[model samples]
Target: MKNPKLITKPFAQNGQKNAIPENYSSSMESNQATWDQGFGPITMIPVAAGGLPPKGQDFNGIFNQISESVVYLSMGGRFKFSADYAAAINGYPKGAILQSDDEKKEYQSIIDNNKVNFNTATQAQINAAWKLFSTDDMLQQLAGKQPAGNYLKLGDYGIGGEFPPEVIDANNVKLGGIYAPAGAAGINFYDPYAPMFVMNRNGMYIRQFQITATGKIAARDIKGEWKVYSDDEELKTRFLGINSTAVSAKQLSTKSTIAGQEFYGKGETITITPQGIGAQPVGNYLKLGDYGIGSAFPPIVADADTLGVCGFFAAAGAGSKNYFDSYTPVLVMNRDNNYRCSLQINVNGRVATRHRSGAWITYPTLDEFNAKKSLGEGQRWQDVKGSRSSGVSYTNTTGRTIALSVSTAGAIASSSIQIFVDNVLCSRNEVGGGEGTNFTRHCIGYAVIPTGSTYKVEASSIGLWAELR
Candidate 1:
C-alpha cells in the first residue's frame, strides 16, 4: 500500500499537486483554505469544550456575532425590527432563551415574548391616554424661569392642545389650540359644535349655572334625569336644555273637590282647599296683591302688628293710583300665567261684591244670612239690601251672609231691593209688574269674614223675610 495513497493526489489544486501527501491531512487543509475565502475568517477562537457543536468556539463565535452585529435588524422602531430583536439573536449566556417557561429564559427572553401582549392593546386608546400626560405643557410650566429636570413630570393643568392653532381636520375647518389671542387673554380655541366645555383662561368653567347656589344638582330637566358636574368641569357637554326636545305633561291622577288632589306625570301637583288657606292656597284663599294682566286685587299694606290698614300699595307714578286699592278679589294664578277671564268670586255665600261702578255691595255670612229675623230682631249684622238708605253694620265678626226674597200680599205699584257698603253707591233691583201674586228669588250662602274687620249689609225694601244662609 506504499502507497496507493501517494498515487492519489487528494490535495490537487487544478491539475497540480502540492508536496503534501495525498491523504486526509492534505484534503482537510485544502478545504479549510476554501472555507476561509468563501466566508469571513473565524472571529471567535473556541475558548471551551462542549457537546453542543462540532467545535464549541466556532459555534459560539458565529452566534455571538449574529446577536451583536451580524443579524439584519430592521431598526424601523416597528415590533419585528426593533432593538430588542437584535438583542435576542445570540445563543447561550449572551442570547435569549425563548420558552413559555420564564424560569429558563433571561431578561431579553422575557422582553421579547412580552412584545405580543403589547400589540394586543388598542393603539388609539393608548395614544389618547398617553396624550393626557401633558408632558410638554408640564415641562413649560415648571420651566417658567428655568429648564425642567429630565426625570421630573409636569402637567397641563387640565388644558390640552398645542400653543398654535392646531389643525385637526383634513379640510382644516375645526379650529382650536392653546394660545393667547390678545393682551394676556389666553383662549382655548375649538370647534363651536364640538362636545366640549367652555372654559376660562385659567382652565376653569367659564361661568357656573346651578339650580342651587352650591351647584349641588348641577343640571336637571323638569321631567328627566339630572347631570352632576361637581368636580369634572372638563367633561364634555350635551347642550342641556338647548338641544333637548319638549315633552307634554301627562295627568297621573285627579280629584276635583274641596281639598282634592291632582298629580301630573311631570311632577306637577295641586290640591283643592276649603277656602285656599293651607298649602299654596293659590286661588282658594284671597291674596292682598297681584300684578298679572287683568289682575283685580291691589296690594293694601296692612300693619304687621295689628293688621290695621296702613296705606295703599301701588306701583310708582302715572297709572298706579287706583292700582293699590283692589277693584276685585285677586287670585294669584301660576300655571302658564295666562289671563283666562275676568277675576270674579262665584262663591256660595257671596255677600259683598264690586258692582259695575266702583262701589262695594256688602252682605252677611252664610250662618248670619240663613237666620230668620222678626222685624230685624235676628237679622245678620252684614245684611245689606240694594234699596237700603243706610246699610247694616257690625263691629267685628268671623263671617256673614245675605239672603233676599220678595212677594206682594196684594197688587202693589212697585218694589225694589237696594244694598250698600261703607256708603259706596250701588244700583237698585226693582220689580215693575207687581200683579196678583208676585214673587222674586234672592238667596245668599257661605261668605268669609276677616277676624278684625267690620262688616255691613243693608236693604231699602224687603217684602219677604231676609234669612241667614
Candidate 2:
C-alpha cells in the first residue's frame, strides 16, 4: 500500500488519555519489510501536565451540557412555557411535555411539532394537538357521560303532550318561586289502570282515593252512595242526611215528629202545622195542654201566698223571687239577688238573725228584757282618790254618765271640801275638829258628771276625797 500508515485516534476525543500515535512511511509497499530496529520505540505523546488538552477541554464542556439534558429527560422534566416562550418556537416537539403559564394544567404534544397555542387555540385545535393531564381533563371525561341535551325549561306551552315540560336546570331550579318544578304548568301523571296514588306504610295503611288491592281503604269519612254490607246482605245504617232536595216523609219509617214539626235535611223545604191542644200527655211528661200534677210538676197555689205554707205560692209579681212554701227555708236576698240576711231558729228555740255583715244576734227572752228595762241606762264607775294636798280631779271623755263622790279629812274647825262639775260648784261640806283632834267628814254626796265635763274636789285644810268617774 502506497504511503500506508496506522491511524489510532480520532480528533477532539474525550477523557484524559494521552494522544494516539500515527506512523507513515513514504512510498512504503504493502509487502515491504521494515527493519525491526528501524521501527521507533513505542513512546507516549507529550500531554498537558495538570489538565486536558485544548480540544479535550472543549469536548468536556460539550459533554457536561449533554449530561444535564439527559438527566432532565430521564427524570420526566417538562418544558416551562410562557407567552414569551411560545413566540420563540413554532411548536413543541413530539414527546415533549409542557406546563401552561398559569401552571394550572400540563399538556403533552401528541404529534410531531404540535403547533397549537394552548391559550389562544380553539378547543378542537388544542385537543387535536395535545393530551391534557390535569383535573380539568378528568372532569371533561365525566361531563361527556351526562345526558345529551340541555336542561329542560319551564312555562313553555304545549307541555305534557308531544313536548315535555323540561326539568329546569339545577341552577334555575328555584326560578318559578318557592314551589318551583312542581309548580310548573301542565305536568301530568301517567296513571291509566291503577289508582292515581297510594299512601301506605309497610303494615299500616293510611288514606288514598279510588281503589287499591294491596292496602286497606281505611279513612275517617265515607260519603256519596256508600253502603255497608255483611255477607252480601245490607246492614241497618243510621246516618244524618244533608241534601239540597227534600226527601218524602212517606219514605221514612218513623212518623213521630219533634215539637209538632217534621225534621228535614239541610237545604230542604219544611212545613210545620200546629197540632190541636191534646188532652193526652206526651209519653209520661206533660204536653202543652195537659194538666201539671204530681212531684215533677207540683201544683202552685196562689191563695196561700204567705210564709209557713206547706206548698208553693204563685204570686203575680214575685214569680222570680222564689217559690215560697212551708217546707223550704227562705234565703233572703237583696234586690240584686245578693244574700242580705237570714233568720234561723236554733235547737234551743232561740231566734237568731244574721246581719248583712255576717253578725248573728239572738233575741233576748221576756224576763231578761224586763229586767234590763227596769235597770234603765247604766253608768260606769272608775275610782279617783287623792291626798289632802292634791285633792282629786277628772275629765269625762267616756261619752256616758259618770258619778263622783267627795270626802274630806281635817284637824281644824271650818275644814271643808267642795265638788264642782264643769267648773260649777255642785256640793260642799264642813267638818269640826276639837282640840287638835283629827277628824274625817263627807261632802254633800256624789254628783253626776255629763260627757265633756270636768269634776274636781277642793279641800280646805288637810283633807281626803274619793271620786267615781
Q: What lDDT tens digits, residue by residue, belong to model 2 across residues 184-213?
A: 331321211222222334424322232224
Q: Tell how far residue 275 is off in model 1, in angstroms.
A: 15
Q: State TM-scores per candidate.
A: 0.14, 0.22
Global CA lDDT of candidate 2, please?
0.44
Looking at model 1, which ten-residue stretch has the lowest summed lDDT?
A: 98-107
Native-vs-model 1 lDDT? 0.31
Q: What is the C-alpha local distance difference test score of each model?
A: 0.31, 0.44
Model 1 per-residue lDDT tens digits across residues 1-469? 3412222211122333222222233335322222234222332234253212233333444344433331223221111212244345331222233221112211222232233211112344323222222232455667686754643123232135333332232122222222222222322222222222222334322322123334344432222243555443322122222222333343455432221223334445433223223335336533444233234534532211211222222233333232223333333222332321122332353544332223444566655554423333444432222212234553323232333333222224554444333343243455565457565434221222233344344433443432232
lDDT of 2 at 465: 40
Error of 1 at 41 (Å): 26
